[model samples]
Target: MSEQRTHSPQEPQRRPRITHNRKKTRRSKAAAALLYVLFVVGLSAVLATVGWIWANDLLALNKDYTSVIVKVENDESFGEVVNDLKKNGLIEYKFLFHLYGWFSNADDKIAPGTYELNTDMDYRALVTNMSASSSTRQTIDITIPEGYTIDQTFALLEEQGVTTVEKLQDMSANWNYKFTWLKDLPLGDYHRLEGYLFPDTYTFYLGEDAKYVINKMLVNFESKMGDYMDQFTEESQYSLHDIITIASLIEKETDGEDYGTIASVIYNRLENTGAETQGYLQIDATLVYLNGGKVPTEEDKAIDSPYNTYLYKGLPAGPISNPGMKAITAALKPENTNYYYYVLNPETNKHEFTRTYAQHQALVEKYGTANEEG
Candidate 1:
């Protein structure tokens, strides 16, 4: 028998190298470290997201609006102009707008003008609109003189690019303009806005409709005359028709308030000539209204309407001009005077008042024929 080594029972059996299990423990430790690192990175990312939200909410932009007029040049670069706006404090955040335009390829289509800008404008839209020759909105100022008839008022508007004079003339006969009071009244030729329209300085936007202008004038009339409608309460004498008729004469006579008294003198003659001879209270103003002629002939006197002082023995049919407050006040409260006839001093625009026809005729002959005044 071969010699067999017999170990003592106290000694243990040794295992192979592959079964040691040390390497396995090391691999597991490495995997756990990697997982821990990944979890830390995810937590950091979540925290950063929360902080960004809070910062954005706290830092909103606030800017005041101002109106400024700018003239754009032909061939000017839009980018250069946007840079100018940022530099001038006219716009906020110039970069985002410029980038948006560059990305969208809309850099060349901006409009330039006096702009009313506020914080309401977005970065991209502000740049897009501010960069050319177009406007978001347009504004204009209109001035209507104190004594303009509707036709004359239209001419003023036409001269200022508001509308054509023909449009106003056409509307006088249009169905819409046929007022409730004058709807059935003929329009061959008539006062467009007599008691209905008012006179005052006003402001308006560009491209306003003709009807809007008419409405504005009417609104003014309502405001000023709302309380004074009953100014002529003694129904037997002072009527609305008479007040407007006298007011129109006052408007034509002079712009001076003092002339209100003189205007009253002429009205008295038209209403109460003191005799029953049926004499005509001839005035050149009606002829001017009818034919735009400076003077009236015997035929103009035969216009044959209630408006004709020559045909009738009283005041004319209606007002000839849009009167101001002074004229209206004078019409309501005429000064007590015995004068009946008057004539205008062409150079002074002042009238000469007299009580008798002979006195008035002498004044007329002297002023009407004497060297035509200096």
Candidate 2:
């Protein structure tokens, strides 16, 4: 009765139903947008990952390795070679390497031999190197001992089938190397390069040119002298040739441990102001050099050759042999001492130093003759 104006049953709340439907539609739209955003981000991440993988596979990224030798047999296929490269850590992606080889037509062009390849090379360089005709050469291991003269070095090379003595002599005489140290060298026989060729183990290609082999030794000598070059030029009164000549004598005179003291003795003999031992480097090694590796007799010491240090004053004509770095360093920096004479003790294979001739004679009597055989 109070609501007498109620009429039928209202209109069933049309406004509320319309507002509810609008809210439901809004929620559905928001969920669809969120899902779209998530799909787009996922797709971008996948694309970035794929791009990085492709770039790394094709390009030589982060490749750091030394030289490696890979042997390819005559019967091996391109795929087999690639597999070997992959196994040797020369390459990263085998599939891409194979594809590159096929595309470049390098698969069939590869030579069958040992290839000296490095890891720093990219796929293109690696393939090209393998395909080249001069990809391989047989190498020989040659060891050049210290204190060997040029003649001895030539003999060793001839023994190893590296080159003939005549070829080496000719190369040494005529080849004009660009080393600054070689510019002022005395004009003479092949022995002019006597002490310059560094003594070390070397790998030379079989049947290599004589010039190439000799240059390798020279380059090594230059490299070994690295920082010492400036020091030698600045600190020493003697020229490089003179120092090398003295070093050769030191190398032949004693074992390595006494180089500095022996160098001092040589310097003392050459520079002594005393009337008795002044300017006479009475080294036995020079006599032996003059005598051609024979034991020096009393008559040999009296010979008038420029190399006879007993007869002539100052350094010899040139170096007697190739001395190693230890002897060279000693010649450059001799110990400061007043002692002028050293007699080799046969029992100890060491020398006894003396400042006076009387002391030297006593030591000679006590230690036996300096020429006693070791």
RMSD values, in order shown: 12.1, 18.3
Where does model 2 exceed 4 Å of error?
Answer: 1-136, 186-188, 232-236, 370-374
Which pairs of residues clash in candidate 2, taking residues 3 or more apart in a chain or in different chains? none
- Model 1 pairs whose backbones collide: 69-114, 110-131, 110-132, 111-132, 111-134, 112-132, 307-317
Error of 1 at 227 (Å): 1.3
lDDT of 1 by residue, 1-374 (tens): 99999977886767667754888988899999998988888878887875554333222234455545433433347777667666655555566556656876656555433344444455555554454333553456666766666667777777775545665455544525533334434665535456456777666433445556566766677678777864545554767666777777667665374655656665666567553323455565665667664566667867767766656766677777777777888877778886766666767766667777677678778888531110
Q: What is the lDDT of residue 168 in candidate 2?
A: 83
Candidate 1 is scored at a TM of 0.56
